[model samples]
Target: MRGLMGRTAICILIILFAATAVAAAQTGDDAVTEGNITEIYSTIDTCDITLTSSSTIEDLVIDVQLVHEDRIIDRETLNVDRINANSRTIKVIRWNVKTSEDGAYKVLVQLLNNEEEIASKEYGFVHGRQVIPEVVIEGTIANSEGVTAVIRPVKATLVDIDYMLVDGTDVIYLAKDEKISIHTTPLTVHKRWNTLLLNNREYTGLVKVRPSDEVNAIVVTDSFSSMDDAKITDVYKDEIGASATIEGGSQVPFDGYVRFTVYDHDGENVVESVIMRSPILLTGDDETVEAIWENRLREGKYRLVIEIIGNDGDVLDIQETMIDVEKSVTISNDITEVVEENNSSPSFLITQAVLVLAAVGFVLRRRNIR
Candidate 1:
């Protein structure tokens, strides 16, 4: 009779647990407890995405994102292991303090239940100031058309300019500082002010310009040609590095530079590089230049990419080649033998004789002077 009573008690407990889970499911009281970043001196940069639930929720995804103004500085999405009923949990994400551009930033944390956003909150706070890139407006020139500012950047960034046309205390604000993102070239940013402003009164101008980190310029060139068709001849290795003879011809005479870049067998990362500049080939000239890599690379397969760049930043020719580098005792022995042969060669003997003669002549001249 005691065994039967024990079995009945177990069944009753299971039913009660099911009923409790059903009731909890009907009342999904889940909320994001904290989405705002906790305030601290700029030393620590951490954001907590905390949530509380009245019932256990499985596989709930939480996405925490922090943005400085419109730019997303950091974002983290996580699938919560599980949240216990009537319990709270917190997930933490690290913030790169470098992204905080010396001012208050807004943060967003959203809790999603089965792909539906159930809870979300936004937070904002101010951070200490930092040295950021800016546009330097040295001076301005004005005419009846518009005003132009002599602008240069203090950092690699983009700058926007606003101008005011003033004619004898008649201040006419033309264009506000319109932010322009640059990613074409790191060359100096100079925009001419020629846009027509309202009111035809001729006026002198003053300008204000601002720089932003989001805007940057990238160096690009179409004239610099990759050595795609370059033929690799006589590729060998000695004490210096991997050496190769690059053979190609150019149809147009150009002032340019040649570069040889080598990558590992994967051809993803550069392992060695060599560049030569000036006195390039003439028109319709077949060119041959020796490219010697100085990096001490281990014995392995490597990919070599050669590029010819014109003075105007254009690619002229490009080619790819594969090589296997090896360091062997036999190679060293062969090199020594070749050196010995070269030292005893007729041309080498003639060079030594000339040097000895020159030294003797110098000594005789000194004796006569004495």
Candidate 2:
């Protein structure tokens, strides 16, 4: 009998709990009221409150008040005529403080229907009369040395600039904590970046400037490509050596070398080869590198291959051409024949001996006569 009584009591409690939840849910769905402050944009001079209403409201008014030291400092009122039923109406109320004082303050935003308060929100702010700077990027130029971003700041501020691909995929470079004191003209910020480290294909440059007082950074983007290149422009060959003219593109600065390889007419046997150091190749500069062969080749037609190699030991370009050697070279057999002919000249030696004998005889005869 006791267990049956307890079971009956438990059933009654379960039914009562379920009925209470249903009543609460129904009350939430049928409630008619003005919505809360959805957004607030506060600056030193003004504060904007964005408010919304769910049900039909008429003769609505928005009150934005600034308070300090538990006292009302300033107030601004805006009137909204009406908001329809079964719909939503949102409005932004801009409140101008008209004060430049620096201190902590409270901002109260209220929505009213004919002097009756419907919804209210309070926000805290520390105003210093500092204007949030408007930053704009004019353009960006890229090269092997780095990327330069032209930016115009409307107000003076300290900012850091970062660069990356337009897709936000990777960071290319960063320049931090640059003070922009001039607001009248555009300034250039350069970040060291080697474009050769990236692909040769086209890419978009992205610059993000973050001011010291702002929470979010401003971004600008531009399209660009890697301008780093080294080309073998011209090649010249002489009797003793060969020289190549190398022109570097405007993006990156580097040092390079020239390698000259001389092969037989068949291009199978390397007859002579040499490697020579090149001058420092700067942006858009032309440098000439020369290589002298260690061994002289026989007079014949040969294949010449010239390679332009960078300081990093990477070959930048290769050029091949045929060279005809027409030098007047004296061989060992001709030298030996000339020596033999000079040694066998008996007539000349006989004339030299006769002249010496005549001189000796005349000297002896003069001595006897004396």
Q: Which candidate ranks first by TM-score, i.e. highest?
A: 2
Q: Which ten residues in a row have the lowest lDDT in candidate 1?
A: 218-227
- Per-residue lDDT, model 1, residue 312, is 59
Give the C-alpha lDDT of model 1: 0.53
Q: Write the per-residue lDDT of candidate 2 for residues 173-207, one digit (tens) a residue.
A: 43454555546678888665444444344555556
- Among these predictions, the greatest lDDT belongs to 2
- True lDDT of residue 53, candidate 2: 55
Candidate 2: lDDT over CA atoms? 0.66
Residue-level lDDT tens digits of model 1 in 260-305: 7888889899888888763544322344555666766676778877
Residue 347 error for model 1, in Å? 99
Candidate 1 ranges beyond 4 A from true positions: 1-44, 129-370
| Residue pairs in clash, model 2 | 144-251
TM-score of decoy 2: 0.34
RMSD of each: 22.3, 20.5
